[model samples]
Target: MPADTARGRLPGFFYRFAHPALAVVSTVGSLLWLAGFALAGAGVALRASDPTTAYALFYYGSLVSLAGIAGIAAVVAYLVVLWLLRDVLDVLDWEKPEPGARR
Candidate 1:
């Protein structure tokens, strides 16, 4: 999903950090995500320019792209773990209930 749509996230569809920190992390993650698309696109375009070079470029691009995705997944895993224990961490929470409201 586009970074802008982070605000569009519906309650309960997914969990998110209620703190401002999530904004910074989300933006950075989105920008870093573009590397995958760029590499894959370059690989696609290179194919018509030169067959032999295209194979190498595509091969490496695919590897790099997959690595980038894996890194992102790892980060998400870390955040998920933290989020699940937000009450104990006392740092971030997915939502803030109203005053006197039950969580």
Candidate 2:
């Protein structure tokens, strides 16, 4: 006899709750990530060249370049984080109080 089952699976209810939560979290996380990348990109552009040059490069060169890199990073990061959480997030047990204390 052979085991017949999916290697990794989450409960349906868990998915129902997690789908919306993940969407909300991923949306906010992505925005924050991109905003930080934008700010940092601007800062680098400003530091790398003069104000006039920075304006030109930022508006033209850096925007396109950083956009591609940041987009890739965001996708990879989101996937990796979600994959790592696969096991940990499925557990629903609550932590017990300290051993010395009564409830």
Best by lDDT: 1
lDDT of 1: 0.64
- TM-score for each model: 0.48, 0.31
Off by over 4 Å in 1: 1-29, 87-103
Model 2 lDDT, full chain set = 0.56
For candidate 2, the TM-score is: 0.31
lDDT of 2 by residue, 23-49 (tens): 445455566556656755776668755
Highest TM-score, which number? 1
**Per-residue lDDT for 1-103 in model 1, tens only?**
4554646654323344444455455445555557657766776888887778767766776666666566667667877888677866766755767899853
Clashing pairs in 1: none
**Each prediction's Cα lDDT score?**
0.64, 0.56
Stretches of candidate 2 above 4 Å error?
Answer: 1-18, 48-103
The alpha-carbon deviation from the true structure for residue 84 of candidate 2, after best TM-score superposition, in angstroms, is 11
Which 10-residue window in model 1 sums to the lowest lDDT?
A: 11-20
- RMSD (CA, Å), candidate 2 to true, equals 13.6
